[model samples]
Target chain A: MIVTVTPNPSVDEIYWVDRLKIGKETQEEYLTRATDSDISAGGKGINISIFLARMGLENIAMGFVGGYTGHVVVRALRDEGVTTNFVWMGSGETRINLTVLEHGREHIPILIDGPGIAVAEGEMNRFMRRYRRMLKVADWVVLAGSLPPQVNLAFYYELAKLAKQAGVKVAISAGASCLTHCLPAAPNIVKPDTREHLSFEWMKLGTKEEIISAGKRIVQDGVEIMIVSHEVTGDIVITRDSIWEINARVQTTQFRNLVGADDALLGGVIYQIYNGAGIEQALRFGLAAGIVSAESREKVCRDMGKIEREMANVTLNRI
Target chain B: MKVGEIMTRDVTSVEKDIPVKELIFILDSAKMSNMPVVDEEGKLIAFISEKDIIKAALPGYFEMLHSTSFIPDMNQFAKKLGQIADDPVERHMHSDVICVEVDDDDLQAADLIIRKNLKSLPVIDAERRLVGVVKRIDLLHHLL
Candidate 1:
């Protein structure tokens, strides 16, 4: 079973409008809210966890939560039938992330990074112990997305190391510091988008070839797979033996928004892996789902039948 | 029965001289299984399938592979890109064609497409210069 751990989580609030104005109050004429709205559950790993649950994978989401906002996140996960175990801090409210869309363009204009949860050393130790125990049982562990400040970059690396020791496959999606540091540790997969790639000084040249070469360099550092994502160019996967390019399937389906495609793709990969598909198949299934998510925006994952059919249409012949 | 009602006027067709990569991108963007290849004079020359692009761009065309993590090796993926590319539309295009005039009955066009399980049929003027192509899906939608 796949297990995802997010150090930070927030409620994702998406607002759709005809046009968005700066420094002006906007009225909601027609607003649609998701079934669950926990602002504190808005991290990459959390997104993937919810998607895995939707895909019918038996998985657990472990993280830290606090206050009323944290409670909302936990409640939503439970309602969604996602087995969640979040370490509760005695202080602070979880943050809320607001996504505003206008004229088919969506922007995360405001993200309230929730108040920091104060955890005593003992409490942190307890959470880590439990997290380590979970790692023991995890077939695949996804250390997802950004962390709230005060969380150490090495924290996820520790988890990855422990997961490796337990013979569990690990996937990490994080910022440059974390991704850069974790490369030597050799997580199975590392997802770094264009912005994250910008921090790599070696990529100053900024050609597609340079960017992919940098990714290949990261793979040489021991990462089994390097998922380098760019907005216009789509996402590319670099492995020791192969370099595959999957263009986002934007034109095929009518687009609603483009927020959760990455998380949805991660979930697809986890789901296919749980179903015993090979790495190649798992990646394809993940990309197919991701493409659908891009089209379905607001909708978390694509309809499974549509995903499968799209996957079928995507023929991946090696060169 | 109206052929105009069922024919697609804003259809996307590739020039015979277009690169295979551009053709693949168009087919992908259009979400179409096949596209009508046309010459500079906008005359139908060939039809290219997704399968054909995949085979041309990818080596080892016979091996059974899964959908995910499938990356075609770019170095080995030599596609004769433009004019001199080995897989030109003229060399590979199906020139033997079933076609219809714009004045033909829509039902007749639909019947021919359904019977043949064709994706599209070239529409011609009295002089047979390309005008529009009737698509199977468009015909089926009219029936609905």
Candidate 2:
């Protein structure tokens, strides 16, 4: 079974529109939407769990939630057949991120910060306590998304270290603060997007070679698997012995939602690994899962059959 | 909604070896009447409550009479409270503790708390490790 930790999760409200324009003063130019809207539970780890559960994997989603909105997030995950053990640790409602996606236009996202999580100290302890117990049953633990205001880099570092001590595999897709700290703990896998790699001076450009060598050095420092997912050049997966590049060909329609694709990719990798598949197979399977979600314009992959069919289109080159 | 949906996740717990004096300070500081006790590996083994401490502090005659009328002096009560300084939490804690799972329904949790007369229901995952707690107040807060 897999366990995912999303420190800060939210209820995302996506609005579809033909055109979206922001006006300085209550004007008619901004009055565009009437097409459709949907709300879903969100957070990088929760998204990954959605894909993992869709792949017939047993997994649990854990995080901090509060107020009525928090309840909605939990209910959303539960309704989707995703087991949840989220901690009701703080006061106030969880955040709701509003996204306006216009046809043939840029996606406009207005994010709201969540509740301050008043008892940050106590909740951090509670989260770790729960995480340790869950790690006992977990084959892979994915730590993803932004940390809540109170949860800092040290928390993720401690969690990754705890998971390692339990002999559980860990795949982390977090931001600079958490990811940089976790690298020293040597997570089983680290998936930092191309933009995140720019933070490191050596990986400023984020080229395929630069990222691969950096991923290799991370292996030397203790990371077992390093995956640098680039927006333009595609994904590069590396281990100490070999480098694998799996970028599948899939036709994306005019409407697309890239919000959950990264999580889908990591979920696919974890899914293949949990089933005892080799790196080559895992990469191919992971890329296909990513494509399946990206092309569907949904936060989760609704069809495992489609991913399986697209598996043949995935190209894994050894470098 | 399940008991877990409204449970307080930041539970204050004490280890078995915790000194009673320190335990008292913990409970007082947290304004709590009872807390769950866990072993080194963090499995719920017992529970300690204000009632247990009072029981431990009471004179032996009180047990036979089941009454506190004999202790007529307020000074005697102060002396009885001092008895808590000696033993560790494990020595005074109730060995049998009941816990609820995260998936348990709110109604079942309410029933357990009512039947057992628990101030707070300790919530545990499948592994029997403490996760959070559902306090009596938490339930009342929601119901009222």
TM-score of each: 0.61, 0.70
| Residue ranges of candidate 2 with Cα displaced over 4 Å | A23-29, A105-119, A195-197, B1-144
Each prediction's DockQ against the real complex: 0.01, 0.07
Q: Which residue runs does candidate 1 get wrong by more than 4 Å?
A: A23-40, A107-120, A193-197, A201-206, A297-299, A312-319, B1-144
For every model in order, what is the number of clashing pairs?
A: 10, 0
Clashing pairs in 2: none
lDDT of 2 at A8: 81
Every model's TM-score on chain B: 0.68, 0.90
lDDT of candidate 2 at residue A185, scale 0 to 100: 84
RMSD of each: 25.5, 7.2
Clashing residue pairs, backbone N/CA/C < 3 A, model 1: A9-A40, A10-A39, A10-A40, A10-A41, A10-A42, A11-A38, A11-A39, A11-A40, A280-B68, A284-B68
lDDT for each residue of candidate 2 in A1-319, tens digit (9 for 90 to 100): 7889888888887776776556565555455744877788888899998888777776788888777787788768765667676666545667776667665542223334344344467656656766776787777889888777756667778888888899988888886556777887889888875434355544543577777777778899988888877643258888988887767665444325556777888888888888899988888878888777766668768798988898988888887
Per-residue lDDT value at B72 in model 1: 51
